[model samples]
Target: MVTRIEWLDAGLELLATEGAPAITIERLTDQLGVTKGSYYHHFGSAGGFKAALMEYFEAQFTTRLIDTIDAENAKPRAKLEHLLRLVLADPDNAALEIAVRAWALQDPDVRATQERVDAARTAYLKELCRGVGADVDPDRYAQLLYLILIGAEQVLPPIGRAELREIYNLTLRLID
Candidate 1:
């Protein structure tokens, strides 16, 4: 039997490749090599499945962004750079984020969830900036950095390790 987390991961994979509109109970079950009944056993409906996706995203961002940044070992600058590196390294995440932004245009719930996650990410970035003694408004810097990071995902071609490190370094300087 597929666990809820497994189902959600499959859903996100489908969303990343085929886009949100392609996600349906039948498609999910087919992708999972299960029956519609199995799908329903885990998620009562398409909305439930989508909600699970959103929850997964929230948990992922919280773990990677909030919890990772709050680690006791890293300094403020290191934490901020680590956050950017994490974002740059995850192509799956970048694709899912692009998919989610598109889905948010039509789905209010998705939009709300995306906004909530964005707010949390921004807040964390802001705190990092303050910790580094940037002498700028944290929210403003956060917003600017967030936009740049998202835009970088689009404009810059997919990068390798060295290129990603360069971009992270540039981001740190930009915000600093």
Candidate 2:
């Protein structure tokens, strides 16, 4: 039997590949090679499924990732570097991330979730800045970092690894 997580994973894949409008019960069921009964069993309706998807996205991308970074024993600089590298290397979530951003432009629910995510992400970056003993205002640095990450994701023709590294290195130097 397909679990709720499986259903959500399929939803995420569909969202990444086909955008927000493709997140219908019928389409997801077809994508998973399942029936509508299974979809309703877990999510009850299309709205339910979409709500779950947003929750899952926030938990996985923002909450869990921040928790992992905070829990790490590495030095602040190292922690930030690791996160930068991870973000730069990530390809699977790029499309989904952009799709969600687009969804936020029209949907208040999505916009609220995106706001929460942005706040959490920026706050974490500020924590890292403080941890590294940076004299600059942590909030400002956090904003800049968050902007770079989000902007890099949105830019047409994704930024190359070399450019990513250069940006990361420059940010690290400024922080240090």
- Models 1 onward score TM values of 0.88, 0.93
lDDT tens digits, residues 1-176, model 2?
78999999988888888898888888877778888999889988888888899999999888877777778899987888877777666677778899899999988988999998888888888888778788787778878888887787789897766686798788778766
Which tens-of-lDDT digit does each residue in 3-100 have in candidate 1?
A: 88888888888888989978887777888888788778887888888888998978875555678668758877788877877776665677787888
Question: Lowest summed lDDT over 10 consecutive residues: which window, candidate 2?
Answer: 84-93
RMSD of 1: 2.2
Local distance difference test, per candidate? 0.78, 0.83
**In model 2, which regions exceed 4 Å deviation?**
none
Give the local distance difference test score of model 2.
0.83
lDDT score, residue 137, model 2? 79
1, model 1: CA deviation in Å? 0.8
